[model samples]
Target: MRFTAPVDGEPVGAAITAEPLEDHFGAHSALESALMAAFDNGRNPIRSVCAESIDQNGGKGVVLHSGLFRVDGMEPDRGITA
Candidate 1:
């Protein structure tokens, strides 16, 4: 997957992960494990996310965005999947 941070249509820092989600393991068990790892490690931090998911989750949860992140928490919104 690819993303571009634009400043008047310019690109900035980017990350490339092959089998990214495979490492991520969207499976329930894997997700839970990852959450535990990140939360317990105290390394993950809040990131710049599209406001739409924040609007949808409404503090009940948050959906991870396709931007730089260390991994904290996220939810799912139909068109706003993260």
Candidate 2:
């Protein structure tokens, strides 16, 4: 996943899975900074941003919540298998 700040045209967040044993460091902080840049610290603040998570009970979900994101609802069979 990649997040960019349109106001300054800068990349704010990125996640790369290069190796199975590689740990995800600074992901939460990066995402939190991205959200803050998009929603809080700009002249043209975005009203909302939508994100989807495959595992709602996992680390991604926890990071989202830390950025004040809430679960709107779930869509059944929304993944590629559907």
What are the lDDT figures for the candidates, one per model?
A: 0.34, 0.28
Tens digits of lDDT, candidate 2, 1-82: 3334322343334222212011212223445454344333321211122223323333132122223222234321233272
TM-score of each: 0.23, 0.18
The top-ranked prediction according to TM-score is 1
Q: Model 2 reaches what TM-score against the true structure?
A: 0.18
> For model 1, how many clashes?
3
Off by over 4 Å in 1: 1-3, 25-70, 73-82
lDDT of 1 by residue, 9-77 (tens): 544433223232323323223354554443333222222332333344443333343342323333222
